[model samples]
Target chain A: SAVISQKPSRDICQRGTSLTIQCQVDSQVTMMFWYRQQPGQSLTLIATANQGSEATYESGFVIDKFPISRPNLTFSTLTVSNMSPEDSSIYLCSVARDGTYEQYFGPGTRLTVT
Target chain B: QQPVQSPQAVILREGEDAVINCSSSKALYSVHWYRQKHGEAPVFLMILLKGGEQKGHDKISASFNEKKQQSSLYLTASQLSYSGTYFCGTETPGGSNYKLTFGKGTLLTVNP
Candidate 1:
């Protein structure tokens, strides 16, 4: 099992502002992932954050909108740029632990863009 | 591709049991189960790899049917804490890639 934490448990921001959510893991892990969850909706994958290379985004997401940075093994950040009301959702970070098949998730950063 | 889960919602009483099913259109290398409480992130429950291995956590257990290309999460003796949305994520067969296509979700409400 892995312990993951995210910054800014909840926040409200202006429509055009940007927020960077930080994710930290207690132990070094492989394959960090970012996700988005709208109210009453399921989790949607945003991208896969690689340490040294560009992140691999999902079909409906782009780097300009949700930029990711994985500078090291234990930390990563996801930035929601120029947020809109539609982007008001819970952003979560997940990491797959080594030597195990489970993926642990951070508490989540709940952002309400108005 | 994403796996399909059944029973969009379900209501159960304390101590009752419920089963959530997840099936994929494509063959899966592994299936992962998670539960998300309201206003929180999804918590990892268990993972079932190919070869019919089963794992359990407390009263919750899951089985993977490799031949059927499906997996089922069984919540036995469910408590109010079990009330949450359940999601099944599928990992396709390939190399060491760590991508999981998740299902929509199954909302479970456990009442007293």
Candidate 2:
């Protein structure tokens, strides 16, 4: 199991602004992913952040709106740009360690866009 | 594609038993179970690979039926601390990338 942490556990941001959420893992991971959970909704995978490569985003999500960066194996960040009330949700970062089928998640960053 | 999990929500009394099911339309390489308390991140419970191997921790156990392309999580003697949303994530065949597509989730409420 890997220990994961995120910056800005909770934040209140103004509409039209962007907020970057950071994820760090205690151990090196083979893959990292970002997910969004709107109020009363299930989690939606935003993208897969691979080290030294561009992140692969899922359908209904695009890089222009949610840019992701993975500078190294243990660190990654997801930025929610041009925020709106619709973007108000909890963003979680997950780490999949090698040899394990499970993905460990950070506490999550709760963004309330007003 | 996201797997299908049911029932959407369940209410159980303390010391009761409950079962959560997760199924996929496509063949699965693996299935993972996670539980998330209100206002907290999802915590990993267990994972079952295609071999139909079962793994258990504490009173929680899970089984993967490769033929059915489904998995089930059994919670015995449920406790009040077990109230939370349960999610099942699956890794598809071919293993191009190991990322998992998670299901909508099953809301489990264990009342004392």
Top-TM-score structure, candidate number: 2
lDDT of candidate model 2 versus the reference: 0.90
Q: List the residue pairs that clash in candidate 1.
A: none
Docking class of 1: medium
Off by over 4 Å in 1: none
- For model 2, residues A5-100, the per-residue Cα lDDT tens digits are 999899999999999999999988868999998856787888888887788888899999999999988999899999998999999999887777
DockQ of 1: 0.79
lDDT of 1 by residue, A18-83 (tens): 999999999888789999888788778899886777899988899999989998999999999999
For the record, the alpha-carbon RMSD of candidate 2 to the native fold, in angstroms, is 1.3
How well is each residue in B1-112 modelled by candidate 1, as lDDT tens digits?
A: 8799988899999999999999988888899999988877788888898658898999999999988899999999999999999999999887355788889999999999
Listed in order, the DockQ scores are: 0.79, 0.82
Worst 10 residues of 1 chain A by lDDT: A96-105
Deviation in angstroms for A82 in model 1? Answer: 1.9
Native contacts present in each candidate (fraction): 0.73, 0.77
Question: What's the TM-score of every candidate structure?
Answer: 0.94, 0.95
